[model samples]
Target: MARQLDEQIAGRFQVGQRLRVLDVGMGQGTQALRLARAGHTVTGVEQDTTMIAAARRDLAAEPEGIRDRVRIILSDGRDTGVHFLPGSFDVVLCHGVLMYVADPDPLLAGLARMLAPGGLLSLLVRNGDALAMRPGLSGDWAGALAAFDSNSYRNRLGLDARADRLDTLTATLAAIAAPLHAWYGVRVFTDLAPDGAEPPADLDALLAAEDRAGRTDPYRGVAALLHLCGVRD
Candidate 1:
């Protein structure tokens, strides 16, 4: 569910709020377009000019109905002065962007500063806790633990990714006094499955179950990575 994620985001919006939204490291304006389509003005900050060009071209090619809703600016997320102002946006998103940054702490601090009072910070990142799930499930607990401890999982970019857990993020957010809200496991079961593996009947059921589990108690502890939606207090 892409639609589920969209709905979850849209449900957070309120009409006539003149909401300003910033997408950190926005890629091709995926979430940006969705949020803009939902009537919230969106400004996307991207570091790559090529991506910005492509996003601009794509937006221009749209049916003129959704074309001008999103603004794409080329800038680094850590210091996106193009859109960064003290307490500017109502919602700030950092989806799938944290994995690329070598140091997330400074990026997080800047993001926290950009939030307006009661503004939502939505983060989507790879689940660090799932690093050993496949090995453990395959009856290789020792190997799993080793990889987990060493942080040797193959990231989506084909490089090593150090997964951050809920505890780590919670502690980080608490340091800023940001109030935490609901979190979810996105693509938890699908990501670990083999590429092109057709969803088996049982696996389909399992995926749906995991979606709920990833949002609930106990099971969420083992989720790939948790989505932390917090408000700046």
Candidate 2:
């Protein structure tokens, strides 16, 4: 996801430009901190208190310059309008967040409004179209059969979550005037890997294969996660 975002940013923005970034549902601030270190001013909004504390601790460990570029905000992503003016950021990220939102349209619209013209809106969502893949591959016939009929499922964390189909999202983005720009599959082959599993000895090769499959279709369509970018025109 990070690699894909970086590539998109590099392609769209000029080098040395100090972009204003807003990371909604930033969790532990992994992407937020990485962008801050690269000289982008980043604001991370997280609703979880424990996550906020962890992110702050991580920020504090960074050098002064990097630390100064990051701000942590305690707020729900849906309230972004209350906290920030429209068109305030060059990049707005709402990764791994929409599934938890029962009604994601309003939140997605708010995120789109946060982007400046030509700004990027990056999203990482579970692939509803491929929801049956995991169960089918695991030989869970009943689960696979059920998955084909619904987008809601219990995630690894045992939380009830929803998934998004690419086609549906494309139409939504168009309606918000942030049309789909680019997209890639994520964790195409590694979705079934055990939680917290150590990287294989040939980690680099694994990533290489994943990257290739992510951009190559038929394969990409069945990936577990979809990394989508929209441009606010």
Candidate 3:
């Protein structure tokens, strides 16, 4: 998925350009810190106090220069408009948060408003279209059958959440003036890996294979997550 984001950035911006990035629901500030380290200004917005502390702790351990490039905000993803002006960011990321939103389109539109013209909006969402794949592959016939009729499910954390279908999101993005540019599936082969499972001996090979599967047809459609990139019109 990082490769997919890098590809979008490489294709859209000049080499070595410093971008203003907004990471909404940036749990633990992983991506925000990465952008800051690359010399971009990053604003991380997260509502969870525990997650805020973890992100700040991680930031505190970074070099002074990188730390200066990052700012952490205690806010919900739906509150971007209240905190930032329109066209304030070059890139906006909302990953893993949509599933928690009962109505994601409004929040998504607000995020789009924060982007500058031609700015990139990157989203990582649960794949609604493939919700049955997990249970079907796990040999849970009942669960798989139920999933085929609904887009909501109980996640690994035992929390109930909803997913977004590609077609639905594509139309929503268009309505917000950020049409879909490219998309790829995420966790195609590794979705069922037990949490905290040890890394495979050939980690690079495994990652490469997954990455390839993510960008390929048929396989990508059945992935556990979807990475979608849209550009502001």
**Would you list the C-alpha lDDT of every candidate in the order shown?**
0.73, 0.96, 0.95
> Given candidate 1, what's the lDDT at residue 37?
70
- Please report how far candidate 3 places residue 115 from its true position, in Å: 0.5
TM-score of 2: 0.99
- Model 2 residue runs over 4 Å out of place are none
The reply for model 1, stretches above 4 Å from the true place, is: 1-16, 81-83, 135-143, 193-210
Model 3, CA-based lDDT: 0.95
> Lowest-lDDT window of 10 residues in candidate 2?
71-80
- Segments of candidate 3 deviating more than 4 angstroms: none
Top lDDT prediction, candidate number: 2
Ranking by lDDT: 2, 3, 1
- Is candidate 1 or 3 superior in TM-score? 3
For candidate 2, write residues 1-233 as lDDT tens digits: 88899999999899999999999999999999999999999999999999999999999999999999999999889999999999999999999999999999999999999999999999999999999999999999999999999999999999999999999999999999899999999999999999999989999999999999998998999999999999999
Q: Give the TM-score of each candidate.
A: 0.81, 0.99, 0.99
